[model samples]
Target: MKKAVLINDTTYDYHHGCEAVVSGIKSSLLVRGVEVIASCPVGVHYKKMNNIEKAIQQSDLIVVNGEGTIHHGREKAKWLLEVSAYAKKYNTPSVLINATYQDNPAEFDKLLNDFDLVYVRESESYDYLKQRGIEAGFAPDLTMLLSQTISLPEYQSRNGIGITDSPKVQEGMWNFQMAMKHGWTFLPVLRSYRAEGEKSATEVLRHLKHLFTNIGWINKENGVSEESYLRARNRFLCYTVSEYLKKVSGLQILLASRFHSLCFAIVTETPFLATSGNSYKVEGLLRDVGLSSRICELSDFDDIADYNAYSFSDEEKIKIKEYKKSSLIKINNMFDKLVGLTG
Candidate 1:
């Protein structure tokens, strides 16, 4: 049987979006008869893993889940890229997929060039790789590749808007306050299990930390207390990812700040309006789907009624349809090339 090693595997990360990406990648390979022998998690030193060296040495391929990791000269990016070098050393084919490449060090070009193929999640990264003379293709993030695995909603059944978390506290504050001001749902992109009832002492401490850290912008308000934000946040917390996705899908529109939330909006064909994320990731995604005009400034949030009439254009719908269709085809071709199957 053909064997493969997955580097930067994020299935265990517990973020619903991360899990979707890993699951899509894994299932893609599995259906092709590739047995993934070793999956090195994010932040782990791929080369130092005791069994990893042996796995790659005997494997037919190495695939890196470059999801949001290969930019800004991060140590994790360096470690993950070194897997390609190891594959080169062992004469095994290597591929990097689902990446957002932006403002990265020029040295990364050399590392990227080592890959048998590089598939970025957006065209900005695709253009960057092309300029640097690397073999590359661009597709929707792997999160979108899971669209077939779930149910989507009909337009007539959807109503209201939802705003989700942001990596930036101030951005998160804007989302939270906007949802409250507009009487919209504040969906948390972070997944947590609530079936166990009371959280452990450790989880309690984490929630305490989450509360304190989340209070930074709220203190400026006259009547808001530290616990107020935490209490409000908990009210809408979801017990499962499927439930969360269903909630997002039911929205008439999503005012999102997280990259994955935007992906969820696209997966459910929910029209979205977004703000900046930590990087160009959000803008890049909107650009990919031909919805670049949907990115709004904070001032635009003042009147929720303004966006009440917002929805996808006929042209934008076609662009989204093309994105979904072409991304699936590109991803299929990517794996065929990876495993040396006749394309």
Candidate 2:
């Protein structure tokens, strides 16, 4: 059997979206008859180079699942640089998947040039890599693969509205006002999980450091906690990805600033208004599936009624379904090529 080492540095203890992305990649590989080895599990630091190198050496292919992590100066970028370097030194066929590039093109020259294939999830990153003379392919986010493996729950919609919190956009008050005006049940979906007393002292200290480092950006007076702004809503927060998906499936509409919240809405076939967060990840995914019309700004909240009225036509739904199929095909074809190369 073919062996593949999947390296997603955040899969173990990240938000449900991260878990979904990792699971989607693994499911796609498993169905293709590949044995998977995850390089980074929760609580294990990526600095463990010996273990990572051993896994790469034992695998037929190395996959760097840089899920929106190739941005400038981010810790994930540093980790990618390290792993890509190891893959090169070990002479393994490596592929970078579902990554977004926000750093200078020059900084990524060596890493991008060394990869056997680079699959970017967003058009902006694709174009950026292309302009810098890197051969990059554009594909939808891997999370779309979840639609294939999971079935949407059957729930009666009571015209409920779901909203996600984002540091980049503070639309909590506006969303709450709209929910009240429309008499829709308000749901706050927490994308990331916070462990109360389950973490070690070092981990807790790291989290506290992050909280204080970004204190200016956090709105404590608005009841937005340091952990996540969604805590302010505190009404109905879905902790797990499954819960979030079921909650979104039941909602008539979602006003989401989190990227994965939008992903869940898409998978659940729930209509939503997406606010662009700190990056183009949200708008880029919508544009890829021909749903750019759903993009909304904070100011657009004043006309929430118009957005609530918007619904996807049967043709549009078909387009999304077809696009999802194509995405899975792309992933499978890439792996096939890798297997052929390694074989």
lDDT of 2 by residue, 36-104 (tens): 775665334455756766778888788778777677656556667556667777788788888877664
- Model 1 lDDT-worst window of ten: 190-199
TM-score against native, each model: 0.85, 0.78
lDDT of 1 by residue, 1-343 (tens): 7888899877445466876787788788888888888888777897678798889898888899999888778878888877788888878888888898877787887888888888888888888777777768776798877677776544347888888867666566666777766678889776443222436677666555545454345443343443575455655566556777888888888887778888888877788888776568788888877889999876675566855577877887788878887878877887777777312
Candidate 2 deviant stretches above 4 angstroms: 41-45, 73-75, 152-158, 167-235, 306-308
Maximum-lDDT candidate: 1
**Clashing residue pair totals per candidate (backbone < 3 A):** 0, 0
Clashing pairs for model 1 are none
What is the RMSD of candidate 2? 5.7
